[model samples]
Target chain A: MSVINDLLGGFATALSLANLMYALIGCVLGTAIGVLPGIGPVAGVALLIPVTLNLEPTSAIIMLAAIFYGTQYGGTITSVLLNTPGESASAITTIDGYAMTKKGRAGAALTIAAYGSFVGGTAATVGLVVAAKPLGSLGLAVGPPEFFSMMVLGLALLVCLAGDSMTKALISGVIGLMIAMVGIDPVEGAPRFTFGNEFLLDGVSFVAVIVGLFGLSEILNTGTERPGKVETPGFRALLPNRTEFRRSNPAVARGTVVGFLLGLIPGMTGSVSALLSYGAEKRFSKYRDELGSGAIEGVAGPESANNAHANGALVPLFTLGIPASPTIAVLMGAFLQQGLTPGPSLFVDHSELAWGIIASLFIGNVILVILNVPLVRVWTSILSIPPAVLTALILVFMVVGSYTINFAAFDVFVMTLFGLVGLGLRKLDIPLAPLVLTLVLGPLMESKLRESLEISQGDFSIFASRPICVVLLLIALVIAATPLLRPRRRKTRSKENQHEAA
Target chain B: MHEQNQAAPPDRPSPPAGPGPTGPPGPAASSALAPLIGQAVLALVAAYVVFTSFGLGLWSHIGPGPGFFPLVLGVAMLLLALSWFVQERRRTATPAAAPAQGAATATEVPEVPVIPGIPSTPAAGTGDGSGGRGHVLAVVGSLIVLGLLIDLLGFQLTMFAFLLFHLKRQNAVRWITAVIISAVGSVGTFVLFGAGLGVQLPAAGIPFLANLGL
Candidate 1:
């Protein structure tokens, strides 16, 4: 099959010494970001974009993409040892993960989690390889109308699935669009919201905004709490027993399936995939009752799903040029920065680059397993870092990161302003994911909508006239309507959660 | 509002448990109408956008001009923010909805594996959780100063002071430890990124400082 040959070609490109080193470095830094508090992958990757300015596009993306997936495995460490889920997908793991820590089986739980993430990521990469060609072809067939509709669906889904209130999420998305409109009118040469500042010409630096939004805001939010040093206890058993392995295998399989499938959908977040994977384990695992306790299956299933979901989310980005999550949107921003638009045309125009990145993903996953297993002690030691010291260092990095973007002090100011904005949004529980995705997609969506209208001579009927556009729009409509129709589910779920907490 | 000031624990019970504050705060007087303030502000922004779009040009025979998309977004924002206001007003009327509204924001505390980030990470702290406002103000103030002074004092000296302030002032870190860390972070980072990677962090602006090779 041509797929085999193309993949082989991809391996040849990926096997280059420079590409391998980049992958190794990406996985390492990605794990650090995951383990380190305050810097999320969105900000971490965004922070590093300036550093990659000198590299070839393929190597740059390969490294950034590795950081993206590397976070998946890194979050599990805190979930198990510190009773802190480094990320949301790892949140479920904290139940059994911490329980295992309590039972002094922390090492086994961590090992299983790492292995599960590897299996899930590897499996999902296979899915991407198999599905990318067909999906890219399908994406190529879409016209401007359909493309516009597809973006609508993505945004609608993002808003619907974002937060407790769809209204807040919608507001966040709209704000993102507004922010995106701040620079020059990409269509016309006139500036809209710049207020006549030269720095506003390129729009707010994406790197500055992102670092401020995700990174600095976090520092402010947790600034008060001085995390006292906690000693990491030594591990009892480093690897799972035979029974633990047997129990984990099926959950890994189930998590991979759930994560990959959910990842393929428009609005599914890693948290959703992990949550659903947890639900599946509860329903089907023979040891389901032990889920809340120190059960390896609990640690394995969701971590696997979380990592798989991460890689699966890439399918949409690679094939359709649509970022499935906020993190992916940031990655897409990186792609744009590299002067490479991610979409079907990428495959045709730069198959070697595309496949090279794909091959690097699998390599990244392997490097993660190899590196993380031996580095667990080092990773755990990161948690022992004083919050004050860590905060200071992170702040310096953020400052340097923003300054290096265009060597502009204006960007540091922008980062500070958005940091305050980020704090306010978090305080109000406004979802940032929708804001991020909309921000990244705004220009493209605007351009596509304008092009479609141009083709139709300003007639709006073209959107409805096309079957794919109609169906995509309908799907968007349905997703938007879900909360309105099932208001009780939303209320009950929140209430139930509140009651359980109480 | 003060109740909301108390940050949420790292882990909270939810349909899918997430980390972060669940909502705004408790029903302070039940009619605590803070959400409305945000909605009103957003509505005003939307209105401004709509007003400004007319100047940029709207739809044309050749199709959408630059303003058309922003116009649509601005109008949609206006309507949506208004809807949010209405929703909040209705919830304010319902006493039971008050508490739920404050807690309903916990959908995912949203740690979507997409970006395994730091959110609600202080639950492990054994210290008394207090006095965040000062720390936040200090951080913000210092960051602004960094931005303003980086071009003048240069990256190394500015970062040295910034890191020194954070390390010493925040936790009463030992003066020796603080200086060592700050020096390494500033001078060391400058060497790694500026010299090695050729990132070109700002050199001192003053003639004397530049001559000193700062």
Candidate 2:
């Protein structure tokens, strides 16, 4: 009842014309970029960072949060309408989504996606309200050692669950940490690896690196493909039949739970959660044969999971001062830039603002369903543009966007360099998400560790002394051990063999 | 070593696939030899990391230094790399190999004949796969040359030349159009960053381009 009343109060603030307009702008811009193939929410949010720099912190955060979910919702249109996937999270959606289009049930797939996103997003937001207070309470007792151990445990989670090659994943993670080390040492204020270059002084601009890696790499990949232009049909009647709805309901429920849980875990964000849910659904679904053949469950599961993951990732950010996803990392950055510390204290200090953002999520999810479902046809038409021309335009936009960050040409060069590096990593089949996540988390982890060490007089035993730290370490050890012992791995191999035999 | 194998395509017939060169160049390398190459690359990277961290003073610090974390990372990498190398060698020593898939497209060479008449794409898409490596090299080479030329000719000229090359190559635009577009792009960038945003553009050796009329 308190949740509802507090939410109603939040709604009054978020419902104001100015705040609502920011949310709308964020939603529309997020949808536009999200519908475009290659660029993900990471790039979309990063590109918007400079623009939001001047806005009030609450409005900026609301807008940024809206964009994050907006991309998750909008990305499904391309996956369904065209064979191309706008985000890696949507790749599973394409398997069934494209199949649906081939079967002339594109309208149904699009409708399910929009509604699934809304349901998952709204559910996760409700979960946030329920979970955050208690989690924040638990976090209040945490100190630097607990925080450091948790981060290490989080990084370990990525090592275990991130796509193949634990060694490569670790290597990439270390590289990210090294990149984070380039700036001044927080403890001593001594320069570490800048090598006297003024550009190195700031230790690689986050905006420059992200824009270059995601935005630029996308352009390069776009340049590689043979563009297939298609025209989109507009304004379809958006309703799922009883049969379609019935089939998807269970998957939607399962995906929401799966995505929410995954989001709660640091390091594995929306993309991983969505993919894992898709895999789980395939393994357990009674309509397994219908999967990858336009099964509504296919669309429902991943779309729901991705949005749920996006909303639920906020739980850790607001409660623990740990960003569970890259999008949240930027939002955390925004919070820090505003001189606000994000932890248990934030809830007590800024209840209205926090609750208002929470309240606005419900409004945002409802708006996304209303706008995205009827407009998916229009969104799908965007893919019809030639990849070459489209990528060129994106490259131009990336340059303009990066330069606009600090209005520096050097930043443009940095974007290009990172783009090439991103392309190189792609060619090697190395997943970039862990690298980005590590880079985002590295400095905070280091600072917390240093703080803990200083507080403990260099006694490392403090890490194990705390109950929370001990539990997280044990969980990490168990996660690290399970893969080596799991019998299901062989079964997976057998399935792969069968797939190859087919 | 086993960890490196995780990056390779599965079903290489070895219990713990050695980190060797990634999958077969074609299909047959899956038996034993391919993983050796992958292991070698991983090993090399591991070695480089160790050397770099050590050279930057990892172990010699009186207390905790900047190199401390990297040293731990390097040792971890080394252990993994060595494990992979040993696994690959052990696999290679075994003799019986699985039947390998022959290059199915050997007789049917996938070729894209360059049309003598058609203008080449300014962009590299739809080109022969050969151009992929070439495109990467070209971009790298372009950057190097721009770095060198910027001091002599200035950013505006270098960027203009670079854009002109792209406009002509990919878009196959008319000379006038290329010139106009390049000029507009360069000047637009200058004004937007320099005047509007208060960014300081690099001054050109050429007098006219240096003066923003500020």
Candidate 3:
């Protein structure tokens, strides 16, 4: 009941004309970006961040929140139609999504994804609304050690989530952490790797890094490959049949729960939850043969999980000041831009603003579905466009987007430089996520570490002495150890076997 | 079981085969240099990070100074680079055996091994491989040219020229489509940064537009 009231309070603020309009624009633009291959929600959000600087803080936040959820909805269409996933979250969709497309059921797969995302996103937003207050309290208690441990765990998960070789993933993650070290040191106020360039003082902006890595590299790579040609499915074939719906219903439900839980944890990326949900669905599937054969459940499970996680991620960010993902770090930047501290006081001092953002999530999810469904064919048409042209547009957007950041050509130059480096990393098969997440968290981690030291009078044992920090550290150790020690492929195989048995 | 799986008749034809010189048909073969480039870039970036961290005087930070973690990160990065470099070297030196067996059965055997800098024609029919390495190099080269051209020609003219040229070169799309996409893309760029979002874009060549309150 209290959760419902709080959500209503949120709705009252979010529904205000200015905030609502921002949310609507965010949803519309975010979806367009999400439909394009090589353009993920993170880049879409980052690129748009500078533009939002002029808006009222709450409206900006609301718009950002809308973009985040909107991208989650938009990304699935391409994965289904073109086999070119718009975001990492949609990669799993490509398995069965492309299969369904091949079987002439692409429309159904897309529809399920759109609808499932709505349910999951809305459910997770409700969770966010309910837990906002307590979550903020929890955030206040997190010091440096806890933050550090959480990031370490996140890095471990990055390695685990990165495909194929664990060693490669670890190396990639370490490289990311290294990149995070480039700018001015958070605690010491000393420049690290600027090479005497003024831009290095602020470090490589996360927006520039993400755009270069995911957007530019994707363009460079996709240009090298033959882009898929997709034929749009008819409207009659868009909705799933009864049997298809029945199969996907349970998977979507499971995905929503899993994504919600994973999303609430600080530092866990949204893609992780979506991928994990997909993995779980495959492991528990009754129609095992349908696993990658255009299974409606495949599209439903991952899409729902991705959107759910996107919503769930806000719980930690809104309630706890700790950002759950890099995009959230950008959101935190927006809050800071407004002179708003995003800790416990955010909920207490700015209840309407906080709740409004939460409430808007529900409204956004509904709007995303409403906007995306009839536009399914439109999105598919957008996806079917040549990759070369699509990538060219991305290049233009990235250039303009970066330039908009500081209204300086310098930012664009930095974007291109990072983009070249990102292109090189893509060439070498290094994962870009760790580097990004680390960069986003670095300043905060440094600040918290310094605060902890000051409070504990420079005692290193303060990390272990704090119960929450100790537990978080242990969890990090476990997460790290599991990937290293566990026979990952064998575990997947055995899980497959169990599914076959069931 | 193999017979059961081979439900289709011989010469009933496979999906019009993918064109890449490396690997089997489809997307995996398409991603020939993706893994290679991704790894190398990561290594280079890591090296740069290490160099920067060293400049910060990694270990000599006074009580929780920014350089402290960076020092640890630098050492970690060096180790990571070394490991990555070794792995890439090993993979290149020893080509996997399975691909060799698969290659034996493929049609249109090349007279020479596919090497860097060699320009192979796009395989007939498939259109999947534009000898990707060449295209990758071409794009990079064009960008370099664009960079040089920017200060000389100014940002807008350079961007407009680059956009027009790259769009035309990359694919054989309709000239009208290309022109429209370029115009819309360029104009959208102007509107988004200049008018809509109210952020300034590079206005080197067109001083008039800059003065027009755009």
Which of the numbered candidates is closest to the native, going by highest lDDT?
A: 1
Off by over 4 Å in 2: A1-9, A229-231, A279-289, A330-341, A348-353, A404-408, A485-502, B1-65, B80-131, B138-167, B172-214
| lDDT at residue A363 of model 1 (Cα atoms) | 89
CA-lDDT, candidates in order: 0.81, 0.69, 0.67
Q: What is the interface RMSD of candidate 3, in Å?
A: 10.5
Which 10 consecutive positions of candidate 2 chain A have the poorest summed lDDT?
A: A387-396
Top of the candidates by TM-score: 1
The best-first sequence of candidates by TM-score reads: 1, 3, 2
lDDT of 1 by residue, A323-394 (tens): 888888989999998999999999999999999999988889999998887688888788666778888888
Candidate 3 stretches with Cα past 4 Å from truth are: A1-5, A98-105, A224-226, A266-272, A275-291, A325-345, A486-502, B1-62, B85-156, B174-177, B205-214
- On a 0 to 100 scale, what is the lDDT of residue B47 in model 3? 65
- Better by TM-score, candidate 3 or 1: 1
Please give the lDDT score at residue B88 for candidate 2.
43
How well does candidate 2 match the true structure in TM-score terms? 0.79
**What would the per-residue lDDT of candidate 1 be over residues B121-207, giving only the tens digit for each residue?**
332211134426676799899999899999999988999999999888866578999999999999889888866667777889998
Q: Write the per-residue lDDT of candidate 3 for residues A1-502, one digit (tens) a residue.
A: 7767877888889898888889899999888877765566667777777778777788888898788778777777777888767666776788889999999988788888987898899888778767876767776676667766666665565555553445656665555556666667676577776779887787766566666665665555546344467677887888789898888888899899999998877656666677678788878878756787777778888888988888888877777676666567666756765678776778889888888888888788878878887777776677556667765676776766665555545665566666666656544434555555555666666567767776776677988898877787787677667755655665578689999999
What DockQ was computed for model 1?
0.30
What docking tier does model 1 reach?
A: acceptable
How does residue A450 of candidate 3 score in lDDT?
67
lDDT of 2 by residue, A329-412 (tens): 766766765667787888889888888889889989988887787777666666665444454445445655665555456676
